[model samples]
Target: MEIQLVGITVLWLFLYGYLIVASVDFGAGFFAYYGKITKQDHIINKLISRYLSPVWEVTNVFFVFFFVGIVGFFPDTAYYFGTALLVPGSISLVLLAIRGSFYAFNNYGAKDNNIYMFLYGATGLLIPASLSTALTISEGGFIEKRGDKLVFLAKELFTNPYSWSVVILAIVSVLFISASFLTYYADRAEDQKALELLRGFALFWSLPTILASFLVFVTLRQHNFIHFENIIVRYWWMFVLSLFCFIIASFLIWMRRNYGTAFIFVLFQFFFAFFGYGASHLPYLLYPYVTIYSGYTNETMGIALVIAFILGLLLLIPSIILLMRLFLFDADYVKGKK
Candidate 1:
């Protein structure tokens, strides 16, 4: 395979890491706030807190890697996406800052402030929704080149069915993914109340997750027929595998068995769907405006960056595994004894 393909594949892996880790973190925040407002904080918030304590700080590492890697490997994306993404990117950054600050305040300072909790929960949903615009715009039609200036069609983005579908999918997927993992975590900790509550959430969101995924497909067909056709003709098997994983994961959750294994299926579900989407959208970083061949960095730089990022992923994965072993899954730690 070409170096550019290897580069984007590695970067996609980084983004996929963010999709799982940050989903759990962000979903936990929303669930924490939900528990407080529903007067069930005593039942589930502790479990949420335990998960968040050691995890939130590392949630953005994957995102940072993807962001920098994309720019490093595909320098032209900065030129095309830089102008188009200014508004949405700024909003995502602001929400991220707000989410982090409020998380700190709610956890360490006020401990139960409604305002802080609301910000935490709201940002959890909003950040992903906002960040998803890049993918939406990538399908093309939302950015216009006007005399060397790429104008992002904010109105078109807001009005497009495909864009909203992606946003809805992002939000629901986060909740479903988060709930599935939390259910597994609750079971591991033997917190029956938390387990039951989170299991309910996991089941409740499953239908919406699948439904929203199909909704995106339908809208993508209408929005970008060529890419949609590519997916149907060439990438159908990947999506089929994704659907299979979803079914298996949902079934395991429903049966209340092997919660850890169920969460692994959840990861596979997204793994296939997410990578398939990226794979099908390949060669074009931003439809019509940029292609891998056009936007890629110098061969020397690309080779060096690819090796560096591969090493980074190698280091990052074990670090997370060690973190999980030491804190997240530790017997005393999960039980809050630590």
Candidate 2:
């Protein structure tokens, strides 16, 4: 029974995982393009601007297809997957990776600096990897029968060729770090005011990521409590950590004078919280009553959800496209208006 249940979990996990990745890619592209324009970089900025509309269009289409897949073909899947829930979760992971990568490659690598590069790289990679791994493992493929002890799926992913990909990702991440840091710090000595503002902005943008770290840690602890025995002080520590994260986020927002940083922080925090909320009640995709596989197999509701999903995609796509266009071409017009 456990094995069968695990198999179903894995299937749903793959779906969620893919959704998360897609959302993250879309979000990162949005943020990156917007950030470049704000920094007044014309070369790469122009290039991203041109492509923004198309990217948004693609994202919208993808979501529509995803929604259709969920609702039309697998109405029962809704009980496990939920509407657009995994989108934010996956996107958050991608944004983290992009942030780390931007810091490593752009900030640290260009100057041949390694410490900041490593710090950001590790933070970015480890957190996303851990989440992805946990999700994958919970789905059931990596559980090995080793004398009643379950070896996690993450351990397996790390051992496989995927580990090599991580090394490459590390390198790319460092490059992005170096680029971003160099750009920010290049004129810092010449422009003290700008530097000060930038620092404040950095802190503001970081609030969500900081809070996310806490949320992820608490989540892991919760999972351990459910699956394993003898884990101590799980709920108590989670509450403490959550409070700390909230305080830090509030403080950063309060201190921020720049709207850009504050906006990014708020947006990221929303997604982070959304994902965190969804994940908190996992192993039971449908709360209170239906488990992932047990009670979610009704065909009629599945078709309705699929239609809803498709409609959602149609709406989301155009909005994303318009947003990209605004960022790429009309960002200057919108900057202070908001």
Candidate 3:
């Protein structure tokens, strides 16, 4: 209920928004290519194209807000994370550019170039894997303050089990989330062929998502015992709820019933787990280097930022809802009747 708490919570919401929206966008790109290679593009590509057409351009808006808000609310993170993130951050940007290029070329010039599809698909996986490095580094041990110089342990990050686990989880979770949503969308469109194919894709990725989640928790115990203990002690219930949501979602998908409900459950699954992990990691933006108390901006600025971000969230959510209503869920548009 402090300003810092409100500020970070708002920022966390933006990041969570990005997690869902961007995951669907990213996963759709990968699935588009996968469908092509598997010769199912004829079945699923229309659904994927329809979903991507209206939303791809806005997928990074939440991310942009979170990145800027974090630095605005917690100036000290810039100092700690700025240099440490340069390589990985640069990689993410490059991958994003490549992905965007594919979108541009496909939309404007070359409709379905295999080379462009490969780049699109590759970036879909690589961008998330690269962006996840920041979260892995946040668990500590990957950044060292030697004198006044902050050195990023790139090799250690590459070799860390927890880092790899998080990357794997990021990719798998994207696939699962995207597939679940697309299955729902295809069903809503009543595209039976696409619906059936996407349903299978959703079921196939469901187990990997849960397994990768457990692997992250297990690896976290060894990687950062303090954070792991905090999760076990203070955050177990949220994770339990997250798992419950996952089970319900997966079951619905498997049963071939209420695909929309299934995706909603998946949303809650990540919502609980994402916010819980964030809440437990609270106070500290990055282990040992910064805490909300130590690193937060002054009261005047913090209050301004908290209010500004809260307003931003208010506006952003409604805009997305309107987008869905107008484009995503519109009776005629969704079914491609118009």
Stretches of model 3 off by over 4 angstroms after superposition: none
Per-model CA lDDT versus the true structure: 0.94, 0.40, 0.93
* TM-score, cand. 2: 0.31
Off by over 4 Å in 1: none
Selected candidate, larger lDDT, 1 vs 3: 1
Kindly report which residue pairs in candidate 3 clash with one another: none
In the range 1-338, model 3's lDDT, one tens digit per residue, is 88889888899999999999999999999999999999999998888888898999999999999999999999999988888899999999999999999999988989899999999998999999999989998889999988988898989999999999999999999999999999999999999999999998899999999999999999999998988899999999999999999999999989999998999999999999999899889778899889988999999999988888889889999999999999999999888875
Candidate 2 Cα outliers beyond 4 Å, as residue runs:
1-141, 145-154, 163-296, 331-338
What's the CA RMSD for each of the models?
0.7, 18.1, 0.8
lDDT of 1 at 266: 96
Please write out the lDDT profile of model 2 over residues 1-338, one tens digit for every residue. 44323333334433443343333333334334434546633323333223332343343244345444534443544533332224434655565555555544653367424443344334444444433433333322334445854343444545544333333432332222222232233222233443344344345444444444444445444443442222223233444444454454445445543333333333343344334434444544433233545544455654455445546546755766576466533544322222
Which of the two candidates, 2 or 3, achieves a greater lDDT against the reference? 3
- Shift of residue 21 alpha carbon in model 1, Å: 0.4
For each predicted model, how many residue pairs clash, with residues at least 3 apart or on different chains?
Answer: 0, 31, 0
**Top candidate, metric lDDT:** 1
Ranking by TM-score: 1, 3, 2
Q: After superposition, how far is residue 309 of candidate 1 from its true place, in Å?
A: 0.2
